[model samples]
Target: MNNLTTEPDMHTALWSLVRNNNKLFSQKRNLEKFRTLLNIISENGTIEDLINIMSIFLYGNNAQKELIENTCLPCLRKLPCEDLPKLDERLRSSISYAGWNINETTDWKQKPSLFELCILACHPNGYTRERAVTALANHYEPVALAIALIRCNDWVSPIRISARDTAVNIIARINTDELMKVWIVFDRVSHGQRHGDISLSKTLFPLLRERIPSNELHLQLESGNSRTRRYAAEVMWHTHQSLNYSDLQALCACSDPYVCFRTMRDILPRLDQRVRTKLLDLVKTKKWAPARLERLRLLMTDQPECMHDELLDALCDRSASVRNFARFHLKEHSDVDMELHYQRKLESPNISTRIAALAGLTEIGSPIVADHAKRWLKEENPRIVAAGLSALPAEVIDNCEDHILKKVTNHSLQISKAAYIALCNSPPLSAKITPYFQRDDLSERQSIYFANLLLLQSRWEAVAHAISFCRHNSKEVNKCGVFWLQRWVYGERKFWMTPSKSDLQDIHRELELSHSNMTEALMKEIRFLLDSYQ
Candidate 1:
């Protein structure tokens, strides 16, 4: 009976009882061992263990009924409600184990235990579940009722009918608190796979309205676990329950983002003037971006006069969605020149604000944005320079090519990477990048970028670039050269005109000079291609 045992020992003990189930059921001493093992399993076993036990119990013969009812049912009831969905999901996905199927008896005179009925309700066999539904009609524990509610969506019609009736009867008799405890299970199952015509909203909402007071519902919204809080909020909203300013404010401040968003989308617009002002103050302090974005949108729609200041502040907001929302509204609703506004923001000391402004001005395509970008590229701060490089347009890239090329060798990899991406499309700058590979100070990434730039050039120049890269010190860069050479010699011959014999000989000679760096496989492929040309 000691619950503290290793998992392998406990697993062996449980399966031993399952293997000798008949002897365990028929003998008195073995029944004691069965009860003890069930105790250890109920305490220390996992979801899979409990599920295996349930499968055994469901397929038990009449001789095993006493042990199953007296010992197994009570232990199974010890399973927490949270584990039921996991049990249900596992049962749904797997077929019943053939080893557990000792008898197929479905007929019984007396009603089974509530926990027993609950397990049977989830039986993978449809008929077994249907029998459990009928047996469940007389038992109404909260967990039992929740399982019955779940089965109302059973793909089998008779089971769904029996379960819906059982759920309706139990919902009537159960108090609000008891019903609330099972709400998470009921809500989960309602949305899960269902083929029946039963609508949970139509069945449960009326009962919720009759039994659940507004204060209790709000308490659920404020303090329940995530699933319960979502269900409670949804119940209150759909039932058209009126929430006081305090309740609305609490909802807006709820740590759950979806609840906060629903409050803004569904509840905020209908508030009275006094409550609206209070809610607005609370919403302004909320840091979640989706809630803030919805609040800004509502302000634009419901209170246009206050939006000018709100939208301007939002332009500096951390979220791109909020910033873009502000930009669109500012352009549509006000005479304030967005270009001038963003221009002023570009000079702000805050790095994030300056980045946002740079992005905005770039989107506006203002001619002065290039001037600001040129100046920003010269700044000592890498962030501003990186932002400037990202916002620099195609027209201005040629103008700033020298500044960008300098950053390609910058000590900060962030600025260097941004500079490389900006220069990637400028074919004119490719020739200037070749000398950078020879510099010993270049980082690993910078060396790779210089090597990869060869792939963007014409065929003969690319050959020269590959030869130059193979002579670099980094093996990774050398691999990039070998990879391109392999592809050019073996893969690209059909795609382009074959190089002249002298050009091929030149490639062969250069590769031979750098052959110490080439792998044996690469040398063989290059030799074959060059011999063909000869």
Candidate 2:
């Protein structure tokens, strides 16, 4: 037999074996055909062929499994070596087809044992855990799916996506308390999206809406656990179906303040005006504790002018949420009111309210308001002073420059930051501010900001004056000076002081001989700079 006749015969024979499988591993043709079959279909196979190949590998007989275990799997374990490049190339193409079909292999009729999944979930390879998490959607066992959902968050990007989408399957169908466990998992991570972004809402929200008639979702919404209830309130408005009006009324009157607030913010806006009015009437008559105060929001919505006094009274409400609501609502009105109705609010006993009021005045930008607010700078309350600094008009800013420079080193960080930001804007204040950078009481951060400003405005002599603090007794102060030196090297064109090897040497010489107290810290900083530069 010549090679030509033998090759075609071999191809025809192996394809026939693939079409009808028996555990016939005895032939060398089987091994060559297996690799050949994967390679031919690997790059350009039809969807049907890919599916068949996937099923072959996943549920194929012992010989096919052994073929992968011995051949492509070993090559894929490392990068493509030069000697056997064809093997590496074929292995990679085959593995891509294999990975693409992981979700299709899930057996919904029987949940895998916890021990098996635990190993996959705990696997160091991200792709393995990704497969395990995504496969949970077809899983029949609720508790097992819940456990896998928690582990999905630990995997890489692909796994996290599978975890998020599969979460909807578990969330929509799971029983009351079971879904709460998923919510607990969600809260541990920082990101959750609604609509077209990263959230269980894309599926779970619609499913919950569909399943509402079952009362299962309702039970979770009203769960004894506050966290579960909170999740319900948060996600309730995201569904395609509107929440039932009676359900909204009841949740608004819920004992949980968080639930009530969430209902008012999310659910109430979509309610009919007549329904809100009727609910407000019923709550006012019934004196529902959790929701009675929520009536102020409706009043603000329908008759905002009539609700001004009531909102003012709410500012004193003991609940922080209520106070925040009042502050925000009042600021909204202050935007339009020529009277600045919240003026009295600047003196409101609550510090947050006072800050909000001052901020309102700031945005309004009335010189008259600044005149009244400037007294806040002298009041000794640093928060009030900070607000005053932010609220002042440019015309009035110079009048307060001397006072602002003093507060740059004020014990209150908020006041000091406001003072630094305000002075940095006024070039005249730069002269007055430079000397304070060297004062022992000044914070290192304060000095860095001050020094940077001087350089930013071409005040080279000021930075030269304060260069000694690079070896200051305060470690924080020394660190700040070193950071400034670093900024100079990175080459900011606006600065007056440019970094040079000779210039740094001269400064180092002065520090070593003139300042014996901080030789070590200074040397450490210089060495770090030298290493980084090189």
Candidate 2 backbone collisions, by pair: none
**Each model's TM-score?**
0.69, 0.48
Q: Pick the candidate with the highest TM-score.
A: 1
Clashes of each: 0, 0
In model 2, state the lDDT of residue 1. 15
Each model's lDDT = 0.73, 0.56
What stretches of model 1 exceed 4 Å from their correct place? Answer: 1-29, 58-65, 68-75, 78-86, 89-108, 124-128, 134-142, 161-184, 205-232, 254-259, 270-281, 284-293, 311-335, 349-351, 378-383, 399-534
**Model 1 worst lDDT run, 10 consecutive residues:** 98-107
TM match of model 2 to true structure: 0.48
Poorest 10 consecutive residues by lDDT, candidate 2: 76-85
